[model samples]
Target chain A: MINRPEPILMKGNEALAEGAIRAGCRFFAGYPITPQNEIPEYMARRMPEVGGVFVQAESEVAAINMVYGAAGAGVRAMTSSSSPGISLKQEGISYLAGAELPAVIANVVRGGPGLGGIQPAQSDYYQATRGGGHGDYRTPVLAPASVQEMYDFAGLAFDIADRYRNPVLILADGALGQMMEPVLLDATPREVLNVPKPWATTGMKDRAQNLINSIYLDPDELEQHNLNIQKKYRRIEQQEVRYEIILGDDADFFLVAYGTTARVCKDVALKARAKGMRVGLIRPITLWPFPSQVFDDLLEGKGNRQLKGSPKPFGFLTVEMSFGQMVDDVRLSVNGRAPVYFYGRTGGIVPSPREVLAEVEKIYAGGAGKPEKAGN
Target chain B: MTYEMLFAGFGGQGIMLMGTLLAYAGMIEGKKVSWIPSYGPEMRGGTANCSVVVSDEDVGCPIVTEPSVLVVMNEPSLQKFYNTVARPGNVFVNTSIIDPHHPALARLVGENGERKSQKEKGGGRAVMSENVSATEDESVIAGEGVRVFKIDANRIAQDLGNGRAANMVMLGTIREVTNVVEMASLESALQKAISKRHRDLMEINLKALHTGAEWVRSHDVPLLTPAG
Candidate 1:
């Protein structure tokens, strides 16, 4: 366990690496990529000190495959990359999912479609939450907004991955990756929850030969595997959805955002409140499960009984760093209960707090929650 | 209290280092802080910038679009970011290379109230005075309220026998002006921020910081003739 009780300055990438090592990750393999090169650079020096193995693979595909091998051996392993590099690892991710290997991957995303600029963007939300890999599978994606969350979620991602025996992702952006912040490392040694991997292909010395394979040629067998994976995903969707609602209970409008964009929206929420508008923020910490239940409860006023009969109609403004991606999830969750609006900037352009506050003002003046024009 | 700062200069001017030191010093003082840099292609001798936020509360956006304090080490940086400084903000300019007559620097009228008495007692170098009025094309937008402090940061560092310590000098000046972090905290942060290979430069860096802080504290004393 890392033991710096006082807050220490650390880059998010360095904090993530340290947290993973503290979480008992024994192996890390990653290729260098923009905005995230610090992860591999950090791991190269720190991993050896902790008796963990670190490899700078030839390519992203090779790096992921190394993680696959390490995970197959029942060791906690992880790989990290940026957008284009993450694209190269999709096939390996799919294989890891199909084989039910517990491994963590971090995507410190840059703008994308092709080799987009090495600036922050939320465009990879669909790719991460929807499982960029092939077939009908899901990866639990944890979107961390702060450097502290980047550290804390590294352990959470590994725990979740091990519990489900599936690939888990930490979805971050270049801004979060490159930013430095004060984070409190645990003062006391954390109790690392040692998960027993009974199905691991460790050696069949006395037990029956453990087979780790993803290929199921028979139609019935493949369907059953798919169904079982879906069942696990459903369990995760119910139990593992993490979200945060800030100043939301007594509000008339909500801003839905995650990761880097969420932090900007939070400032906007405070500013809007200061300006006499009741604005709240819904930040989804876990992007995969999408925290739709919170949206439902807030939209229908199910949780806040006092607001049930209130005359004011509440609205949701989904903010993202993408052209529009997570907005779809917000719409799906809102599902016509409340009018959903969106404001976003694409191609690595982060929205200023002023810009978001202006949007909130426009929405507030236009009489929020009405069935209105589609957002830009 | 929250102070959002932007530091911009050429790639090797230690722009990122200035941000890092402030962030680390703030953290040491038990303040929440964040630093984010302009990475990738921009580092190739072009303008490199970093945003740093120090707050009693959690920092919301690490990117500083409306900087409460702006430190520009080059003319290009001052030209590019002069308008982005919030009203009633603080601006620290490295005047060694930049023209002292730049119109955006019209706000460098006098010393801040807190340091004015110190300036009287110390009898140090004089700051720029407002003789010529600013023209419309190059003046700062909504910049009348900003308190501009100009120091020849590179020259000060060079005087200390290391030109690279300009960032440390600037850091000292910022600490003196903003008091965002303690000088002791900055000293300790310097020990941590400097790597082992560069340990020898620590004393010079600290000296540069002290020199800078000294310059700002007594800059209005008119020991040296004011730049025209």
Candidate 2:
């Protein structure tokens, strides 16, 4: 009998490492960065135990290149870094995208423009969703709010990356990276992790040689490759747009948030409802592919049954740790059908629940989330 | 009840660990917890603090603006954070490091505890210790019947032969005061918090906790339950 598992209290970064290991990730390379240090720290010790390779590269750029090399070897590989470090890996990430390398890159983002302090910030939303590096492509971006998601998404990221033959990004912020919560260490067993990769560059014995490079010398060939990547992105957008709509059916106003910000919004939603205000939460799980359709269907009063009380929502208020990066997506999807307001805190400052609630109250008091023009 | 706490002290006093240990212990008890350390220049030298929230329900906003419990291991942390405690809140001051009857140097003004009249420091970040000078006032802030519990955690840990485990001493008082997690879980979490190489110091850590908890139990004035 497979030994029954017991839940253990774990930090988010550690859970990511554990999850990656359970998902059969045999190679990890990254330089240490705060908030994400625990991931590499755990992997350094745990990888040897699992007969996996863990490399502490000289720099973030070197670390991501190591990930590229490892993934090119047809082994499950990953790299992790914080905001500034992630910036260093952008060039490597762009290369991975061009090469169509199936790899997972986790960025436990911190505040930034330039080494902007080591506190958590969701400012990397645009960086993750819209391409961070010089590229005309997209990487599947997963935002995990809790430690459980941190664990669960690690394996899922590798699968998605492999399935699409593209790099995947786990866009976690410092708050989620550092928080501790109860999690099942290994939900996915070793036997279930045997995904096939025919395009991997292994030692060419009897098989044809495989080349892992993003270079297309010909303009026509490069254009064609870009179009093909676009096709894959379209397919991803169609098939995958995961989100959770909590009691938004009856809500006169919807609060859109993700990760740690979503938790604060949930608390505000509860408080606002308790005070007889119609407030609810809608949290997006997948940052890329944007889950834009969920908002569209909700606004149109389509198949989503949980939106019970109101036939349609008044509008959405996007809450984030950054100064309204994801809010643009919310507005793009809502498309003027309903007003959308943005409340955020950038530069490593975390918003309190009460601070978010006060904003919610302001929005609600402005007459059913209509959001009377600014300063009105 | 949601248990929100702020642990504050200098860089190496294990202030952050106190919050982290509570968070871990809460997780062991199947509770939700978020531990957020002050991840700025303040962590470099002068003062370090972290906010920990433990709740049976989901925790929103890991930043505890007005914590339900405030544990101060140093005088600067006490001065910097004293007023942020929620009314009818519990404040644990380490008498070993902070004088009970001390007046803050900076003149008090607005409601938000923003101190004015400060000199430049580290690119104008306004170091908390430098902003507030000392006074000889004998008015005790953590006096009787105010829900402020004073304990000599430093001395308690020193008595147990590990002065670094003063965080554990403060944690013991936290267990007794908050009762957010079980004592057994706290003890086990403390054991795990210590590195394996220092297993020899485990006994003394436990002793320090017990001693601190005993002092709180014996000295703190009874807390009146807030009526719903």
Q: How many angstroms is residue A136 displaced in model 2 relative to the true structure, after the best TM-score fit? A: 2.1
Could you give the CAPRI-style class of model 1? medium
Model 2 error, position A97 (Å): 1.9
State the TM-score of the second chain for every model: 0.80, 0.78
**TM-score (C-alpha) between model 2 and the true structure:** 0.88
Model 1 C-alpha RMSD vs. true structure (Å) is 5.8
Docking class of 2: acceptable
lDDT of 2 by residue, A1-376 (tens): 1223766767889889988988889999999888799999999999998899999999999999999998888888999999889889999999999998889999998988888878888988998998789979799999998888898999989988888888999999888898777777654364444558778888888889888899999999999999999999999898777788876767778999998888888888998888898888989989998988777777887775566336577768888888778988988899989888878888877777787778877766774344433211
Q: Can you write out model 1's per-residue Cα lDDT over A1-376, one digit (the tens) per residue?
A: 3586888778899999988988989899999988899999999998899899999999999999999999999999999999999999999999999999999999999988899899998899999988898999999999999999999999999999999999999999999999999888878765577889989888788898888889999999999999999999999999999988787757788898999999999999999999999888889999998888876676555754534543334688889988778888988988888778888898899999998898899887884444445455
Cα displacement (Å) at residue A327, model 1: 1.1
Question: Where in model 2 is the C-alpha error above 4 Å?
Answer: A1-4, A187-193, A308-310, A367-376, B104-146, B157-165, B225-228
DockQ of 2: 0.47
